[model samples]
Target: MRPKQLNFPLNPDYGTGATIRRVSLRAQSHRVDAHLLDNFHEMRCSIVHDCSIVTAITGESVRIPTTACPAAVHQLQSLVGLPISTPIRDFYAGGIARHHCTHLLDLAVMAIGHAPRPSTEILYEAEVPDELELPVPMTIWRNGRLVCRWLVRQGAILEPLELRGRPLGTGFAAWASLVFEQDQLEAATILARTWLIAIGRRYRPSQAAGRPARDNPEMLGRCYAYSTGPVETAVMTGEKEAHLHRLQREA
Candidate 1:
């Protein structure tokens, strides 16, 4: 089936925070004439347009809607210095990829106990290595309120090296809220882990059916690499839950 077009417009006023005005889709001429599936089902098989944009906005710095494809979502991952999944080849081309990816991250984070915080007073923080630079602007939010911002300063020193023997650029600055109670932190951690696991299961070449044999190597590599790091750390550390829950009750 030919792909469709989905458009999501971001509010021009960055001051009121980023807002999604609407999401609309259009089918290809050939596909328009063909019988179509429901929106939910069609999304599963179709190429979603601009899917990476949503993932890019939500994964690291922003907590927005989570609905994007795994590969496109991975491409949105600023930490990984890979190209965005090729539009034509990726499952869910267009916005569908992004929407699926966002949902995966959101689901994973929620699974860990990182519920949305109620206040914007908390400080959001993340630690990054001095390499594998972030190309996009980093946004900081507290209880859903935008607070501060930073961009990955290029020319920074590289410390960590990938398996490829290439020096990792400066690591990415993660987005979280400063006003989050301890429970919220725990929840967020859990949610992030869950999201990763979900993405890994759904998109990993080893798990997905119908993928070509030649495609296996790269997909496997990407899945393995994307699943590592902070999310893993969050999963390993069970301490955050109790502490966060207590903090939430007190709040």
Candidate 2:
């Protein structure tokens, strides 16, 4: 499917030999609009918050892997009455993530978290290399400035001795939180989320098109598409799940 046009400009060189993800956030006095684009998904979220509470929220899945994924956009309404005062990382811990699209929820929290900040807008770019085994750099950028870059291999940081051997998967944000604050904290969060999605680049979408999440043992009870009971049978395509299953069965 063709990607939707974004309101902001992107770095033309950002996509070279890498999977690039961009999150554009713009804010008014009481509303924040967020748009996300990457190789496998494109989504948008708008959060209307008063000084300290979210009064309204909406989300749209512009491009996604599965038909069921779009329904997660509606789950964003659940955040309508949530407090904006909650920390961005803590928002997901409140038990709202299990029934929502991870990316959409991420956008929602970002929009709400930054609503009170003085900046009118922010742009974040993350580039994860196609080849992780080589010494190529993985990077995260904020606005137009480079935030962090590292040589990564097998999900561990190889360069940047301070972060060497650090796992990029689970517990990354927690470790980053302890080491960063304010602007650094925000950058680390975006980088962590981007790394999660960038792995989708390893698989093509056609391998599992129109498959139900319930059929995949790895996906049961994971996210909105995989929610149990009535929704478990929803046609939810999963790229990583497809790849893993293929490797297991084909091997």
Candidate 3:
């Protein structure tokens, strides 16, 4: 039997507070487990790998935006036996992305890369306030240290002259690759993703369960459930778990 979906709130009120997203990755011997938690979703993924190839993969959507979202977990099986030596994005370039859940795929890939390391755990925390009218600081912390801080207004970066005028979406990963060192690049990538995701806080999608994916033009074709084309019919699950205060409490 599939595991039961679990729900618990890190914050009682969803859209009224800061939005926090946390990622945790742990490695031991041949296995690695990764988890992602935010206001809208909670997902877990794990991989068992040999020194060079992945042997097993598992993913679970603990909390999600739509009913059809859970079906994407089965797609993780297709990634078993995949070679870990190559860049993962190369596979996404080949159209493998539209077949799986985006967050789960990212966690599984992170696990594969982490399997060869000594037993360790890495944590990433991101915070984006609900206020976006004037410039606001968006930040990311890696392993408990503040690693990224960018002033954002609307959806574009306004402070840090080098990053000024860059929108938080599309080309962000590519542009960040050219700007940061390896470690900083990874943190910036998380920050960029969370910033865009935080937008949901203002719209409060959790209350609109059962709404069709195709109705949201901006999210269409972005991931598996949304890419189902004209027949796309995934709806919100109406179950939201927020940790919007977790980061602040830890501070």
lDDT tens digits by residue: candidate 2, 126-199: 77776533665777777767888888776678888998887777677667778778677777767766666665
State which candidate has the highest lDDT. 3
Query: What is the alpha-carbon lDDT for the whole of candidate 2?
Result: 0.70
Q: Write the per-residue lDDT of candidate 1 for residues 1-251, one digit (tens) a residue.
A: 10121112222322321111111122332111111111111111112123222121222212211121223334434312222232212322332333334333332222112112221222222111121224323333333433323232332222212212211121111232342344444333322222222211112122223322222222221222223231222211101110011011111
Report the candidate with higher lDDT, 1 versus 2: 2
Answer with 1 or 3, whichever has the higher lDDT. Answer: 3
Each model's C-alpha lDDT?
Answer: 0.24, 0.70, 0.74
Per TM-score, the best of the predicted structures is: 3
User: Worst lDDT window (10 residues) for model 3?
Assistant: 1-10
C-alpha TM-score for every candidate: 0.22, 0.81, 0.85
CA displacement after TM-score superposition, residue 140 of candidate 2 (Å): 1.2
Which 10-residue window in model 2 sums to the lowest lDDT? 242-251
Model 3: lDDT to the true structure:
0.74
The CA lDDT at 128 in model 2 is 73
Q: Could you give me the TM-score of model 1 versus the true structure? A: 0.22
- lDDT order, best first, reads 3, 2, 1
